[model samples]
Target chain A: MSATDELVANNARYSEGFEGPLPLPPAKKVAVVACMDARLNVYGALGLQEGEAHVIRNAGGVVSEDVIRSLTISQRLLGTEEIVLIHHTDCGMLTFTDDEFKLSIQQDTGVKPTWAAEAFADPQEDVRQSIARIRNSPFVPKKDSVRGFVFDVATGRIDEVV
Target chain B: MSATDELVANNARYSEGFEGPLPLPPAKKVAVVACMDARLNVYGALGLQEGEAHVIRNAGGVVSEDVIRSLTISQRLLGTEEIVLIHHTDCGMLTFTDDEFKLSIQQDTGVKPTWAAEAFADPQEDVRQSIARIRNSPFVPKKDSVRGFVFDVATGRIDEVV
Candidate 1:
């Protein structure tokens, strides 16, 4: 199916009928930091619902500058108190070398790359490292809880990494 | 069950003794922008496997500063050539007025509120707006595809929003 068709199909299968506004929950303040891998469904894996947690995702589920900023806002501005960082197994971020990725893009688009190399290496270790970065980051409330996990995509399981 | 128990259960159910590392398809490099709402399971909804597409998530699935940064890296540095932004219904980001949220937080934490009225507002509209922002974003390749949708927490479905 075309991308648009796939989207529409998925939407039709998953979205229909509900029209009213959502009733807010009392525990409306948890956050999850997860990878951008489509295969790892954070909700189904964790058995969560809307308003139960705020999710933050990026490459490797690493706590980058953007994660810190959103997390800060989620906590200070939106009232979230807990954060769960979820990285996954067999991640693409764990696969290609920077040069290979750049070469593929260069061949596909013929455009010169602008970003540096250190950005895409060792995704698993990156997740482990991000946990420490987030824990030590000044932006996150010192008392706020932060935990890390690795989601095994094949098994629909998550392992606490830190 | 604890997270570890869940992992163990899933592993027992799904893992075959093939042990030489799970064989995965070549990463197709798609980007997914989804809500941090724990209820929306992008993986199960999409039937995705590990090492498939990249996922980017934030509040209301809104594209924030960090989302853009991640997108830049995903497209320019990583191999993603398409983007899917997934928003959802019944999102907490839409549930309360800024003042109400601040009041609730203040009452809970007993901290002097430094949050602003502009902090909280319409979530559905915000998600649609974020999709537009991403489509028009200079960081995203013009020819690279970008689409937006809304996942219904009640129905476990997603609707194309833009």
Candidate 2:
């Protein structure tokens, strides 16, 4: 069986003990933008219950146009008031530059991508960058508590980016 | 105190019992594109442990350009082979139309967004849309086991969209 099949089986097991249908809006009034890193389990690391916050993630957790779109809907429609951004140590994004990654893809496929790969040199700096993107966007209205963090993958701790 | 502050406190508790970092690449060789629904805890519902799979989320779990970017990195830079697309029932995306959402944002912000809101009438149909996107993308090379599902929020069950 593929790994997908195993997860499906696990899903069956999860549903057996599940009690859900929580409210649609986030209870904690917060939204978290974190990297789609496999090891950075946002729920576990943040102690976030299922209905507490809107979790938006992507390659580097960088605030791309899509992230702004998500956050706009999260705050405007779902009533989330605060925003949290997280980038972690040893991220795959740090391994390559945008130009290199796009060039390699272009060489392989013969077509260049229009979007930026959003690779960054430092996670903490990217965290701040993500925050600034959120702050600058006119789409997302709630910004009183927009904070960023660098999660220590080795230690499972998050240091706030000031 | 702000919700962010409370989550920071929770993070302190999480780190106290947390273990060191696991490997960077996903162990299960899978990447899940899921909706940023507050109640759709991808980890709990999928029974995914840390380091198992890359969880990419957004407003509607729609296959946007950013998702393609993330998947390209996942398959090319990392080693993920299977792709799981998940859209859940009772999502906020269903409550509004793209035109309505865009107009509302334009009215509130005095500037219209270039991106679509990605609202949909049905989760199952959108699941098919998401699957076709990955299948058609030249950037993502591995497409052997691409699957889609509609997560039932009430029952915590994910029915495959075959």
Candidate 3:
């Protein structure tokens, strides 16, 4: 079976023991922006239960336009107040540069992507950058407690990026 | 204490019994694009462990340009083969219209957002729409196993969008 199929089977077993139908808004009133890295399990690492927080993740958790869009809806419509941004050690985004990646894709497909690849050199620095992006956006209104963290993948710990 | 502080404390407890970093690449070779709903716990619902799959989430789980960018990197750089698109029942996206949401934001912020709010009326139809978007994108090469599903928040069950 494909991995998707296996997950579907897993879901079937999960539903048998599940108790859900939580309210629409997040219980913790926080929205988390995290990396899409496989090993950075946001739920487990943050001790998040189902229906506690809104988890928005992307390639590098770099606070792109889409992330702003997500956070706008998260705070405006859903009433989340705090924002958490997570970038982790040994991220795939740290491996390549934007120009090189876009150029390689252009070489193969004859079409270069217009969007910023959002590659960053350091996870801690990128965490600050992501926080800056959030603070600079007028669309996201709640910014009092926008904190950033760099998760240590090997140690499974997160240090605040102050 | 703030909710962010509370979660940070929880992370300390989580790290106490945590293990070393797993491999960077996803072991399952699959990427899941899911909605950023608090009720839809992707890890628990899919029985996914750390290092299993790349989870990309947004407000509505719409296949936006950023998603294309992330998937491009996931398939090209990280070697993921299958894609899973999940939109859940009772999603916040179902509550508003794109024009109305943008207009409200424009009124509040004095500047309109260029990005689409990506609100959809139905979860199942939106799932099909998201699937079509993946099929149409040239940037994402692996499309043979692109499947879409609607997760039921009440039942914690996923029904494939066929």
Candidate 4:
């Protein structure tokens, strides 16, 4: 079976015990922008319960325009008051620079992308930068609570970016 | 205290019992793109354990250039072979039109986003469209295993988009 088919079968078993819908707004009033890294369990690492936060992830957890778009909706519509940016150690994003990745993609498929990969040299610095982006965005109604962290993949501990 | 401070405290408690890092590659070789719905527990609803999948999420789980960028990194670097897209019911993305949201944001921030929200009227069709986008992308090397699903938020059941 495909991995998704396996997931479907697993969902069948999971939904057998389904109770009811959780609320729309995140209980903790926070939204998370983190890396889509396989090893980083954002919820478990941060002790986030199911309905406590909105975790939005991308390649590097880099704060792109799309992240700001999501944060806009998250704060404006869903009542999420704070944004927490998390980047982890040994992320795949740290593997290549934007120009390098774009060139590779260009060689692979004649199509060049306009968007920057938002690659950075340091994960901690990336988190700090994302925090700054969110803090400076006019879209986020509650920017004072925004913060960033770097997760230690080895220990599953998060250190503040400050 | 800010919500992020609460998360820091929570992480402190969690880190005390932290086991260790899971492997870098997803055991299941799957990457998931899903909505950042507070009520949608992507791991629990799909029965995914930590380290089993790389989940990329945004406001609508829309398949944007960044998602393709992440998937490229997932396949080219991290060894993920499969992509699964999931959209859920009662999505806030369905609550507003792009024109409306754009106007609202423009009014609020005086900055206009060039990117579309990629919002849709139907969740199932949105999943299908995202699946097609992934399949057509040259970035994803393993397009044959791409699949889509709509998770019924009320029942916590996932229906395959096929």
**Which candidate has the top score in lDDT?**
3
Q: Give candidate 2 regions above 4 Å deviation.
A: none
Runs of candidate 3 exceeding 4 Å displacement: none
Candidate 4, B1-162: lDDT as tens digits: 777887888888878887768788899999999898877778888888878999999998989888887888888778998888889888888888999888888898788778786668999888888888887876677887877888887898988887
Model 3: share of true interface contacts reproduced = 0.92
- Give the alpha carbon lDDT tens digit for every residue of A133-159 in model 1: 887765567334566677776666566
- Flag regions of model 4 displaced more than 4 Å: none
Model 1 chain A worst lDDT window (10 residues): A17-26
lDDT of 3 by residue, A34-85 (tens): 9999999899999999999999999999899999999999999999999999
**Which ten contiguous residues of candidate 2 chain A have the minimum total lDDT?**
A126-135
* Clashes by residue pair, model 4: none
Q: Residue A55 in candidate 4 has what lDDT?
A: 86
Taking the candidates one at a time, how many backbone clashes does each contain? 7, 0, 0, 0
lDDT of 2 at B137: 92
Order of the predicted models by TM-score, top scorer first: 3, 2, 4, 1
The residue-level lDDT of candidate 2 at B38 comes to 85
Error of 3 at A8 (Å): 0.3
True contacts kept of 1: 0.37
Q: How high is the DockQ of candidate 1?
A: 0.28
lDDT of 2 by residue, B1-162 (tens): 889998899999999988878999899999999999988889998889999999999999999999999999999999999999999999999999999999999998899999999999999999999988988998999998999999998999999997
Question: Residue A156 deviation, candidate 2, in Å?
Answer: 0.3
Docking class of 4: medium
